[model samples]
Target: MDSINVSELVERLGSDEDAVRKMAVFKLQGCVLDPSFADVFILEDGLTKLRHLTLHATGNTLAYSLTSFSRLLEVDKGWEYVNQDLVERVVELVVTHPLVNILRGAMSILVFIVSHPYTASNRISQPDSFGFRALQPAMTVYPQFLEMLVSRLSSADHALCANALLLINSLMREAITNDSEADWPKFIKQLQDLDVIKAVYTLMQSTALQDLSHPLIEFQALTKVLLRKWRDVPVDLNKSDHRRALKSIHLASNPERVTTPVDDGEEGSKKRHNPEKWRRLGFESETPAWEFEEVGYLGMMDLTEYVRQQEDGFPKLLLEQSTKLSEQRCPIARASLAVTSILCEHFEIEKADVDDAKIQLSFESRTNFDKVFKPLILQWSLLHTAGLQAFFRLWQTTGAETEDFMKIADLVRILLEAVVGGATRVSDVHEVETEIQQFELARLRHLQMELLELTYEDHWGHHLGQMRDELDHEALQFVKEQRIRCLLAGAWFSNGHGHKSDNVAVAKQDLNPSNPTSQRYAKLAHNRRFLHYADFDVRDDEEPDLEGLVEKIDLTTVSSVVLAPSEPSSSTTTLKATHKFISTRKVTIYGYLLANSRPASPKIHPRMGSTATKTPRKEVTLLTLHPQTQSLAAEWLDGLLMLLNYKPITDETKRLIAMVQDYGLKIRLLNVRFDDMALAGDSPEIPSREGLDEDYYYDILGN
Candidate 1:
């Protein structure tokens, strides 16, 4: 294809015809791809034209222009063409573009410019050079760029988010690997000030990346460079205390509390009548007319103030966000847990840096552990069973990734031991109860006991032994003895640890099968009234029997009650009494009440419809009833719906609770019928069927 005229194409870029402008951009893309042609094009001021199109063009036109501009740097000596103006224009495009492709293209050009081998060193030492001018502005506005990228990482478009991550990774790689090494420390400190580390950590956690190998590698490298202690660098206590001093000054000078008080003439005249005032007021007094000393009164720092100053910083934000995110079951939940663990680990390692011989954790480390890890553990105990199981699974899978996952494994181990220790604290039981609310304390106590039972096996016992080897033997022995005492007191599994058993075992009565009393009891049990479907033949005989072949249906199998099957084909198959019984697995059973039965003994006949061959078929009853049974049928349907909706105390319910409390799974109860209404000291009331409305006890048998 013949190349378009450079001057004409440049003019055509501003043409009213969109097609001519796109054709000009397409020709420029071809020119930028070839080094010889790119040099000629740059001589013709093509870079300026492309930058204009990148800013003013809309949609794919802007995206294509960005791509062409990025390709200019693929040639040797391409760094000379870059300048501060071009950098600003590209950054603006990156920040403002609504389209992902445009954003990606702008990010690519930015990364390409920033990652050039000459850009970092030249920007620091030779600020007047072209490379320096291009790169210095990018480094200056990095915090804003970082915030934008972090926000993009949570974007719904995964591909756009991936591009954003790639750009960040490129910047991090350049920052750490630059050979100048002079300004790297200052740059890293700036990154920390922007909270880039925490933001990236959060982004990585919340994203749905299938394979985190690349991003994790980049993050681990960044951490190794950024998390280290600065050698021989003295702490700048002046900068650290600047914020507090400003706050204090602002408080002292606040006009709301420091207004000048005006004296009324009556009081002034009365004071002037005194002898001392008359002697001092020769009209030339050394003291001021009104004392303003009260305005300068600033109180000394109280205990609460000191604590608030310490707690109101980044630590507080971390604790609050981590607590809230830990209870969620999204992909980010584990990441949140992992990041919290890493942060706590970093603090511990920092505290230990002061003393080489110290094996015990410093007070600061212990305090941070309590702040970051304890609330998360407590919240997890209440809500997330899936998270707990995933934590344990990660611990088990840490062998292949020894260095990578060791911190996570250690944190989980510490949480488990802490739970056990807290549960078995006999001396602090009363104090612990007093510190928190009664309800939360009881919940914590219950969770601790449940976890103790779950962790009593061989794998957990081995883990405990490993933890014991790391701690002092005397301390370990004391904890073990306390655990034994708690277990023997029946407190580990039972709610009431201090209460005595009410009764001993009683003797069992023997049943004589031949006795009339035993036979009568057996007959009653066998003939008990259970709601069921009675199947019979649909022969051309006179009428179907109301009581024929009956099959029992467990009320627990019923998940929901719909008015009828939604199948349009079956809408005309029955009368107005049609209803359905939906199972937990979503199997639909169509049935309606018979119209000829007695009111006391309501009967239901199965209406046949769609059936899956794999499902065990419920027997279809062919019964007919009188018109009076319709009301009884409606009552039975309403009662069954109500009963199915009520939460029951079955083994499945117990298993679900255990899963949530012990495993941190995200299972929640769907049918919430009762609240924890009983007071802490009230006797538990047993529910009975006597207080129910009339519809609840509709008899299904004509005994």
Candidate 2:
């Protein structure tokens, strides 16, 4: 309908003739569905006329007016004109109205008003304004309304039950937002008094509602909310009857297993000791040991068994629901799994055991579980974070052994594929000028590092190499820093233990006490006090004479890098001042470079000179550069690690490197420079470097 027709209908709503007003309201109800008509209707004071009709009109007219108001209130602007008075009138109608149609319409208006208070401006300003308006009508009547809704849950009409479920869910959610911590328990107690849980559970287990997906899904959501809220409420085990009922439910849900009968024959004995049998039960028994009485004891105990051993609680009820829902392949199954995972976390249950139990309980076999969960993990966006947590825990547990190593390898491959997919999406953008595009690129790089860490072992080198070959080198750094981190985490750096070095080459030099140049050189080198030439080229022919500097000052006793007290214009000036004074000026630092060096044992002489004694050793630092800014140093370090092809020495070091990559330590490195700049209260002035723009830098770095 057009705006002119809608305006004409609104005018007719004020007609003296009852049939004319009823017809106008019926026509306007359909008209209000169109946004333009609704805008025009509201503009023509249609809500005032509708309010009158809701009070004076009967039957279909009242229903149509309520329905129109519900439709109009859906628009965000519509709520601006809605006041507490209108909400109270609707709540009154909901309480007094006996007709199903009027009740549904009135309840729907309340639903839209209270649905997401944050979505409507006026509602947020007064936090749960609609809920308070609806429920504040003499306390007794509001409880009656709640009881009325709960009673509808058991009604034969599916539509009534569904509407009732939706409104209850909305009201419960609003209560959680508005209700204070102290009052929350009282509110829950009120719900229990009305038998709300019983009614919802009836709807959940009702075979009649099984085909009705909408109501069933809403029921599942309601169950999750109730479980989450009730988790904090302490269980009352003081009552003997309640405890007995709880124990009965727990035993019924988790029955003791029936042990297999042992036969005296050779075939039965072989069957009892079969490795495949133990493996199928989630054990890693390659060969049967006759010495051990209980072979698969630890493996057989899962989360369910652990929970059963503890005192009976509400989680057992949720676990039962989850197990039953697992038989279905709908959204409710996913919801059930998510709720169970959350409960497990709340109870401080071991994630690995929970994952194992989830798989064992949900699927008929390991292969079936793998087939279902593998795709879910690959499509992780479809799963909730709780579900993902469970899946990752399972993967971590299974991946620790050789039995399910292929599955772990496949998971690594899937993660790599996701990284590649992210990069592909970034590349697909026409110009990577938007912050979102940059974020996508960064997210992908992070994914790459995580994958690198997961496959840090040498056995998974082929997968890592494959990913490296497939990824764009210009875009992705290819785990170069992670490899260097692994090397640093090893004993070589941490404990000063040496490994076989392949990067640096040291020249053999004779330490002769009689020759002054050789003696000074040995003394200076032994003292470990030398200045790093920042601008010195390895190809430079005019190197500083260490013997000449050593004669000027006793360099043997110095134990730190000596710098010029004043800023030097050239390396020559800095080298000349090495014997004068120590300086603390901060310079632009880069990174460290590792070089292969052979160790020489010292043979002390009476004249403060040592002879060269050859000893086998590994790598040593060729040069060390202190970082003025962490981010720049990280980039330089990554470049060096990539160029040098460093690898971690120990498995523990590899794990630590993997953890570092997983935490995005490289990304964190950028924060140091930004924080320093922030502390200095200065905006970064970009140097005139090629392929750099100030605006582009701000676009990427700014929020």
**lDDT of each model, Cα atoms only?**
0.41, 0.44
User: Pairing residues by index, what is the TM-score of model 1?
Assistant: 0.33
Q: lDDT, candidate 1, residue 638?
A: 35
Q: TM-scores across all candidates? A: 0.33, 0.36
Best by the TM-score measure:
2
Cα lDDT of model 1 by residue, 342-410, tens digit? 333433323322122222222334222222221122222121222233343443344223243444434
Worst 10-residue stretch by lDDT in candidate 1? 516-525
Candidate 1's error at 494, in angstroms? 33
| Candidate 2: C-alpha lDDT | 0.44
Candidate 2, 419-470: lDDT as tens digits:
3233321132222112221234345445555654553533334544554444
Candidate 2 least-lDDT 10 residues: 491-500
Instruction: State the local distance difference test value for candidate 1.
Output: 0.41
